[model samples]
Target: MNLIAVYTTLIVVLLIWIGARRNPLMALVEIGREMLRSYKFILIIVGMFSVLALNKYELQIERKMHLAADYTSFVFGLEGHFVRHVQELFYAPWLTPVIVFFYIFMLQSVLAASLGIYLLDKNRVLLYATCYTIILTYAIAIPFYLYFPVNEVWSYVPAGVKFTMLEVFPRFEQEYRPLSGLNNCFPSLHTAISVSMALLAFRSGNRRWMVISGISAVVIVFGIFYLGIHWLTDMLGGTLLAVVSTTVAVKLAKLTLRSGEDRLRVRSRATHTR
Candidate 1:
């Protein structure tokens, strides 16, 4: 199989394994049923996918614009050799693959499975909140990616961090670089998304999902540094973004669902009168 196929299959398997804990087979069926039944649910799913598409388009725009600007120096100036020290302090040949696995696969896997698990639990509020968090996170981060560019820590020689991701996924640049730009390193989306998912999982009240997402977030955050991909400032900014996105998304989701409920009640009353 090709790289994308392999990644997708693995992610699907992981999602099933997690979702299976709570009748996720029914949840899978329910996702379809709900989408067909509720325009609001369908719209939320569309909005989620639309933001992802926008993210891809934004990458293309960034490339065509050729924003040769590099803020790596500013990041390095703020935090000198932090990533290098972290790597040097904990560099292990055996640990590389484990970290790379989480970096490459676990982030996206947990994200996808979170949606499925939410559906399985029948928690529409958290599901909508998760989708909204994703939309908001990308919406805010894309601007920085376009305007304020920062290279990866390893790419910046002054940082003295080695790109450990290369150790395992040597063809990462050739395979994955198309999806992720080399210079899009200001606020680590991996950090933000993983952390935001974990925050939402905690709110989901699913003990299993909470543990899974929490571990995924912590490991991914550490992996970014261990893999020599993101700087300290990037992680800090990402954490802040996660907080803002999650808070706003939760409120927005509640309001949107409440409004939908009110409209449904009004329609019911109208039907009864008729």
Candidate 2:
């Protein structure tokens, strides 16, 4: 992934969102100004990268743990019966293009859902919460990645089953493996992030985004499964992670708000007493 393109696109999305309410040129300048003023926004980016960097180092340890552990049976046995049907349905020749599209576009969907709420709906609380939820997911997942480095389902194909994300997207391995460790497949972060964005969109009171995000999240779940990148259990793990992270993010935002309010209340009392 070209990180620059990803962020540049996010910024453009932000500009477009702001443009809806103001002059397009003014919206662009205002977004630039807001980026400069919003230390929290910068900090959120910093926090996400910090966790990601830590992941590379931690994955080394996880790799060692992977060599020492045998978790394939544990994970595969728990995979639901419907997972096979899902794989069969998704692996169809005609659906190959759709699966590939969803695999790559899932992150953009997340950006749209979360940033749309912030930029269009003007819900800073929900924005902060969404960022926090994303980071919290990383924090939670890294530990699992470290201890339980389950390989992708592609490595453990059942009799008569096939895995095609690699076959279809020939460059995927060369491109994706460099950035991500091979064994970080226990709980799918893509699924978790997508699901969390959907949840937040619903909570954001924007019906349009809610529908869009909800549908995108479901597609992403199937995309991961059909691509043989994750098992049914990974999606379940991701869903649970999303719920936990969203709850934590909401609490974090509320706590920050409460603390700010308390400081203001203290100042008011101090001024009156003086």
Candidate 3:
């Protein structure tokens, strides 16, 4: 089963448990409300995955890198001009991978918002913020991917600079190898997702976790460049995407809340008049 099916099943089970114990009607109503509110986010994610899948079939088209090669190269030159040093301060194989894994997993901000929804019984703000962030990031990224398709500098790094473990990692090689095509490296999804998680952590009032995540994000950003998985320009692009996405998400959340409040006030006044 796909992720949608799995998540739907889990939600159904939770609703069933809620119905069995306290109030079935209220549980159904609550679930319906949440589904409606989050529908846009679900659609965006599905659309992104569909685009990625379809791109896989057009292998010949992807191989050309005609989409955004020159623009990406220019941006990369600007980033490379600022590189001060290439130091390997932290080189633990186990540690880097583990940190990277956790950072990626944290991008599932929906799960965090869901927890807030369950505990506080009102997390529309968090839900809206998370959804908006995801949607905005991909929306902004799609054009850049087209205009500046970049194969990471790491793809052609000097043999001596290549990290040993990364060079040998089959899965990583398969995903990023330039020969296989699909190399849009101007913006690092890793950095965008990491920054998104850090923002969510902060908004959720988990300052301690936010600080830790912030530090981890910085490490991952550096690690990706150091490992040659991304160009310095790619990291900058990722940072820009994250900032734009977060800003847009916040504005959207505020608008949603304001609209909700206006509706509630109108209803209250109508009831009072009656």
Candidate 4:
């Protein structure tokens, strides 16, 4: 695995341990059992990862399309060097690495740990709802990425924002740019996914998970602008998307799971009568 993968895996494992108070291996075994016991669980997991994989493919297609309409000017117009001001206000040599770490590593760690933590706590409803939330997040965001192309704040020179990410990950453009397009700045997924995960965790009834996810979300959101990667408008758009996605995903998960329970209840009654 690459250094990024290794670092994220370590962070995820640590988060799962702290939140669930169990070895991640044991939690994985339980997760596997849960998946085996319910096809719905398996399907939701598959669907969630499928959307993530599709997002990677979408980045490739976006690069090939050479999308010509840069809305960076429009976004900068609305938010007028907000990211630069943030960097100027908060920038520090010591703080940059901390912000960059959260910006890069913590988001994925919290997301991965959310799954293990939910399963270990036997919170099936929240687990399934998270999957749906992820699916909805990408489904909604991808269209904006494809058509409403907005460049990163630092990339628009007029914004006067420096790409602070390069301080820590000097090879960011070489290594990470392929995974993320320069122009996929609107409705920052970093904000949406992290905040949405925290929103779902609040309903999980696992206080530890709630605390962990909550702090991670807040830090990741702040890290966006501090890293000079996102605009104020992007963060605002992402927050709105987070609220809407989690709200809809929770309702849909309850409706879908409740119907499945009803079917199982009917089956149980028919078997007992026979």
Quote each prediction's TM-score.
0.90, 0.79, 0.63, 0.92
Q: What is the C-alpha lDDT of each candidate?
A: 0.83, 0.67, 0.54, 0.83
**Per-residue lDDT of 196-228 in model 2, one digit per residue for the tens?**
988876666655556667877888887877776
lDDT of 1 by residue, 135-226 (tens): 89999999999999999888888788899888898899988888888888878999999999999877766666778889989999999999
Model 4 ranges with Cα > 4 A deviation: 63-66, 259-274
lDDT of 3 by residue, 1-274 (tens): 1453465545544433332333324544665666676565456446545654544443455446544355535655566623223424555566656544443333343334233332233445555666677667766765566666666554444312443335344454554343234366668876886777566546654344446557657766776655656677778889988888877776776676675442211112222221
Error of 1 at 268 (Å): 30
Taking the tens digit of each residue's C-alpha lDDT, what string does model 4 give over 1-274?
Answer: 2999999999999989988888987778988897778788888888889999988998777778887777888887887977888889988899889888888899888888888887776666677778899999998999899899998888888999888889898998998898888889889999999999999877765677778889889989999998888889889999999999999987777766786442221112223221
Cα lDDT, model 3, residue 215: 64
Task: Give the candidate order by descending TM-score.
Answer: 4, 1, 2, 3
The lDDT, on a scale of 0 to 1, for candidate 4 is 0.83
Q: Is candidate 2 or candidate 4 better by lDDT?
A: 4
Worst 10 residues of 2 by lDDT: 265-274
Candidate 4, run of 10 with poorest lDDT:
265-274
Error of 3 at 178 (Å): 11
User: Once model 2 is optimally superposed onto the true structure by TM-score, how far is the C-alpha of residue 112 displaced, in angstroms?
Assistant: 5.8
- Which candidate do you rate higher for TM-score, 2 or 4? 4
Highest-scoring model, TM-score: 4
After the best TM-score superposition of candidate 1, give how far the Cα of residue 239 lies from its true spot, in angstroms.
0.6
User: Residue 243's C-alpha lDDT in candidate 1?
Assistant: 99
Candidate 3 whole-model C-alpha lDDT, 0 to 1: 0.54
